[model samples]
Target: MKKIDVIVKYFYPLAAGIEINVRNVYKHMVSHGWDVTIHTSTDMPEAKNSLPVIDHLDGMNIHRYPWRWYGFVPRIDWAHTPAIALHNFNIFPHSWLLIIVLIRRTLGMSSPKVFLTPHGGFTPEWRTFSPLSRFIKKTYQEILGVHLINAAVDGLRSVSDWEAVESIKHGMRPDIIHIIHNGLEREVYTQIEKLANQVTTDQVRKLGRYLIQIGRIHPIKNQATGIKALKHLPQDIQFVIIGPVTDPEYKKSLDLLISQLGLFDRVHFLGVISGVNKYYWLRHSVVNVHMALWESYCNVIHESMSQGCVCIVSRGTALEELIKDKINGFCVPEYDEVSVADAVKYILDSSHARQILAMRKRNTDFTRGHSWQNISLQVEKMYTTALGS
Candidate 1:
């Protein structure tokens, strides 16, 4: 069987949305009789550099190269061209890998068909990036990166319809675009639900009448807005934030805001969690809030819904496709405090609890199509199509 080369910025000892999605899908593919090798960095820019090493996880081969000099450089030795090269997260490693492949092809060497998955990084909303970074990225794309992505890639894999439109706007050929939504491992959720139903964990119950938001603590997550929404709710309503602090300054700002609002006791920040502990909170929280500036498709929303937790997401994101306001879930018009507060208040009010529970019961039926096993089959078909192209 021809092997597929997977290039990502980081793998293992770190958990991000893109990393989780790649891990789950490829692991499924491997089990289904596909050969997948992941080429990734040992650490991200924030972590200390280390020597390169090779590792394997659940039958998937991983080559972890030292990410010295801020993860901007990558060292890869391709003994032979792979059948397909799928690049996730279009940053450093992807750019460098593309350059190397293009150079090899130019020298009459074997070249694998390339696939690009920007993972929501190329949407027009990306124009909101900090001025200095935005200027540098736009200039690079206009001068070289855009052309490389358009001319060299065999296909552009999109996780949502909105993402597909964004890629087309950025010069990728529409014919080569494929929309493959992210998948959920139902078995994982089944196990979690079993644990969550047994008893409310003391740690989660201690927070009392809280709402939860699970993701990185970054400005793009729009967490400050969620904090401000607390003003509109009853004082007893605690707000629990669960995720790794990706940005210290942003966390400080959140802390400062918590102090300013005098919500020291009411607001709680529980750093990164997974497994049964994660599901416990999701299963019990009054609402799961995910109001981000832009998200390709948030896995947490599906996880929360699967656990029978009511979800309130921001409108205009890919999440809009999965949620229906006043039906399966709630969608706020904007990420502002007023909008979020209104959505929360509506769901938390005593009168609405019955309706919310009704929707919760229907969540599993609605999300049955997202099984990761089925999604891997769709990915396999796409791989076949890309190789044929």
Candidate 2:
């Protein structure tokens, strides 16, 4: 572990799970005088033409390459990094980089000690896709994904125990998998601490009474569940949705459903918010309802809880680990419409005000303990294990 470099195909500052994980964790590593470098893609849709190909900041070497097709990036000949970490989700860098490692190992080229953190990469949920898409995923996961990992990867960094099963299904060794969850940024908690006092009457009026679902609009995310839950809540409380529409068709279906229910006025969609604006909305909201079908790990859950907002998350996924069925917060059975509605209504009911406040207190205490500084130490141990030092 002489030099620590991370590879994530799509890297942005202070956004998304993988990007934020890299920014927070590696910055701590850099402060400790560890050699931290990040290799990422120059395909930032938000920045368009603004990002430079090469830059250096926060005591790290930032290298950006043009992404051509299907997570493909042109390789540059630079000094080798002995230890490399791959941040993965459904696709991109991990899937593509795995192929590179396979080819390199097959050609008898020198291989780095690679560790992979699979944030929901190649999971069983892909079976829900269309036949052609399913075939492509199956072929990749069973054939390429497994072989590449077995050939080159030295260890696995899993965010939760739930994902260890998914990693094993893809043929990763269980003993080598490290269960290290993501953590909240210190600044985020700083903002929450500032809100310990009551907000003014005007400030409360401005924020409005609402429940929020913050994530990309996708069918797999099950945003429709939130809409259905809204039908059970009171009329004054609108459902605030803040995330980009990654799937327009799904968004259209939600619009149609809202029209059918005649609740157009009660459902507000504010796409892709960040920084304090997003936090203010979450902090002042009535509650946060997230019913995504599957997740390797969810950062929004931690963010919502840290702000003392009660969360109603789905069960049988990584969310269960976060919202421990009334231990900290609530977990409705996933896709059970009646159960979901009942849970939301129960928390919102005036009779249960004391109970909900207790839950909020427990949630904030639990979430506050998981800061990035704590997570960095766990990640450094994973790196050391992977490097066998």
Candidate 3:
């Protein structure tokens, strides 16, 4: 059997949930007797200075490339820069570099099957800011060196149905797009149980329960609505926001709102807690509140439920597909702070009902079906089929 080569444009130290997916899938594929190599780039300072080469991580081969640094100087207001110009002048260079590396590796390999999992970066949401940005992305998709690299791939792997739909919109053959839900590491579930014990003991000392929200503090997540809804809740119940403050302006705005609403004490911003601390927060919280305007699939929801934490999510995008209202979790209308508050209050007041529901949902074993082991099996089948054809 030929080896499988997977090209992912973004990988590690980025710490997005997608990173977990990529890492686990790579490991799983290698364990299944598929020779897997992941070509990627790293922005970590230590990685930046080293020679760009392949290294063994877990069971897979990881090839890292040096990304061009535009300047040593950093700007305070980077988002203010025109996105289209940045896409054309900066991001495309990395995309092309990835293409060149893919071509070189593919030529030297023994007719290995190639796969590209863009990991949400190639979506319209990321590139469709302006007409020019859309035009440039479409042009690159159609005729650029990126397209040339894409053409060599046997199949395109998408993490969600939304991504598969987008791939078709971008002219990828529907039959060639495979929808695979990203998987959580088995360690996350184990850590959640350990965290529950710690948080439950600590909860005895603290006043009332907390509603937790986790993810990057960015405008795209619409966490401000979650902060706003905190005012509507009873004084006893607090809101805890845990995740990296990726956008300073957004964090500032959230801080201002917390002050204006007199929720300074009621709302806690726990910046970027990970590992055991992350699991502790999730396991301890009364309810996991995720009100993102758009998300392919919120891994936190799955992680929270794995720990038997009840979740309330916004009703839009693929969230509706992942969360069945009143079954696995509660779903609220978009931007309706009152609905969010109502759901939280119901979960708080009816703790027994909520726990029963959450436990039933958690016990359903949704994560088992979506495990990286199973996903890798599917991908291996695709690779074999691609090779045979």
Candidate 4:
């Protein structure tokens, strides 16, 4: 099999789920005897001084491109503006290197089967979020980004069917859309589970029953709604919001809402816990709640479920496909505070029922078809098909 050159915008140090996915895919494909090289932006200062070059990491080659620095942007103000500005100003510049690399490869200067996974870039929610910015993005997508990506790649990979559909809506060629769910490494999942079980014995004694919500602290995630749902819950139960404080203003607003609802003590903001702590919290919590308005596919939901933590996700999108109501987990109407509260309360009150459902639905085998090894095999097939091999 020939080597595959994968191009992505930026990765690492951010600890975003998409970054993790990119890293895992690169690692797994190399392990499977496929020559895989990733092109990404470099964090190195000296590399930033250079333009249109390649930087090597371990045995994996990462091509670096100069990105324009937008210095000292206030987080609060930026959050209100279109998310695309964040992407355009920082991430999109790296993508322009794709054209340079493609031209070089066409001129017989480089050789590899090329593949592109834009991560969540092709989604409608991201495109539709800002009007003027959306127009700019749409123009870029149609003329430069989409066409270049289609022409440059041997295959297109999506994290979910939702992503594929969204890409098609934006006019991507249908035959090229390949669905591959992001996966949890088996070893990592095992380590987390073992650590979680040990911590459950210690933490369950102190925390009692609680709900866990994990993601970036942002308006789209609807943390305020979770806080509101706590107001409707009995005093004995609590809600724990975990993950990085990505938006300070949104965090402040959530704090104010919690205070107004008088849930200061009841709702806890455990900012960005990971490693053993993340697993421990997931293991001890009675259920996981994801109230985000949009998701291509959530790693948290799959990870929690793999750990036997029942989830309450919002209806619509790929979430509906993952969760079946009252079975493995529950799906309440999106943004319905009452429904969310009622669902949480029912799960808390009926521990035995929740446990039974969880046990039945619990997936201990993280290496099931969703593993990156398996997904990469499927990606390899797509590459072969695209090459007409």
lDDT of 3 at 275: 68
Indicate whether candidate 2 or candidate 3 has the larger TM-score.
Answer: 2
lDDT by candidate, in order shown: 0.76, 0.75, 0.64, 0.65
TM-score for each of the candidates? 0.90, 0.85, 0.76, 0.77
What are the per-model numbers of colliding residue pairs? Answer: 0, 0, 0, 0
* Candidate 4 to truth, TM: 0.77
Query: Could you give candidate 1's per-residue lDDT for residues 288-388 as a string of tens digits?
Result: 88888788877888778777878888888888877888798888865578878888888877898788778898786777668788877887787778787
Candidate number with the higher lDDT (1 or 3): 1
Ordered by TM-score, highest first, the candidates read: 1, 2, 4, 3
Misplaced by over 4 Å in model 3 are: 1-6, 33-37, 44-56, 59-63, 69-112, 126-135, 138-150, 188-207, 275-277, 351-364
Residue 142 error for model 1, in Å? 3.5
- Off by more than 4 A, model 1: 44-46, 50-52, 68-79, 84-86, 89-91, 187-193, 196-200
Lowest summed lDDT across 10 adjacent residues in model 1 is found at: 68-77
In model 4, the Cα lDDT at residue 383 comes to 64
Query: The CA-based lDDT of model 2 is what?
Result: 0.75
Mind giving the per-residue lDDT tens digits that candidate 4 earns over 1-389?
44655444455444556666767666765676655555455543223433345555435666554444522212122112111111212235434444644776678764344456666665645522678878866677777777766675556778788788878887788876678787765544456545555544565557677888988787767777777888788787888888776668788898888878888778878666665667668766877888778777888777676667777888876786667788677888777888888877777665567564654355444325566667657766776676555
